[model samples]
Target: MRLLGIDYGDKYTGLAISDAKPSLAVAKDIVYGKTRQDLSKYMQEIITQEGIDVVVVGMPLGLDGQPTQQTKKTAKFVEWLRTVLSVPVEVMDERMTTGAFRAEHKGSARPQRDDAQAARILLQNYIDRHYDNHR
Candidate 1:
């Protein structure tokens, strides 16, 4: 089953996809949109083209595992996405994936699209924790 991972943001969103075996995740693209409606449209197109069976959205939680404002917003966006898409949507904790990515790429002047990379981390985390368990 193919899976799409999302790192939701206010201005820019990150996207990643799982491989055909649904074992590995890779960065796909970054989507820029003004509103959730616009983001949903872009996501729908990718989902259709990639034949995504599931969507794993990264939930931004506080260090204490508490829900942050962004977490609530992402939840709403996920709810909207669920209404439009036919695939199952799930949320995975994404606390420090971005920080980890940055730390790994420290001292680099190159533009690292952290959002997409974080999405890849989020997706891979989900696949390792959830899909692997099922298998």
Candidate 2:
């Protein structure tokens, strides 16, 4: 099973893809300044091209697990994705995903690269949890 991970942001969205075995997540690309419809369409193209089985989006929430404005925006995006995509769209808690990337990269971090890395972390976390539970 293949999976696509998305780190949705206001200006730029990051994307990641899992290997065919769905074991490792790799940073794919960063999409900048796209409308919601355009983004969804782009995702659809990727879904078809990559043969993705599922899409995992990073769900932004407050540190206390409460929904914030960003969380609401992400929810709206997820909802929009569900309406347009054929495959299942799921969200994984993305708390500290960016922090994790920043901590690892430190001074070397670039905004575009960091976003993709954050998506990679989020996807890898989901893959790990899923495999661990199944095992």
Highest TM-score model number: 2
Q: Each prediction's Cα lDDT score?
A: 0.87, 0.92
Q: Which stretches of candidate 1 lie over 4 Å from their true place?
A: 109-112, 133-135
Residues 1-135, model 1: lDDT tens digits: 999999999988999999988889999998876577777777788889999999999999999999989989988988888898778899889999898778878888635468999999889888898765465
TM-score of each: 0.91, 0.92
Return the lDDT, model 2, position 4: 96
lDDT of 2: 0.92
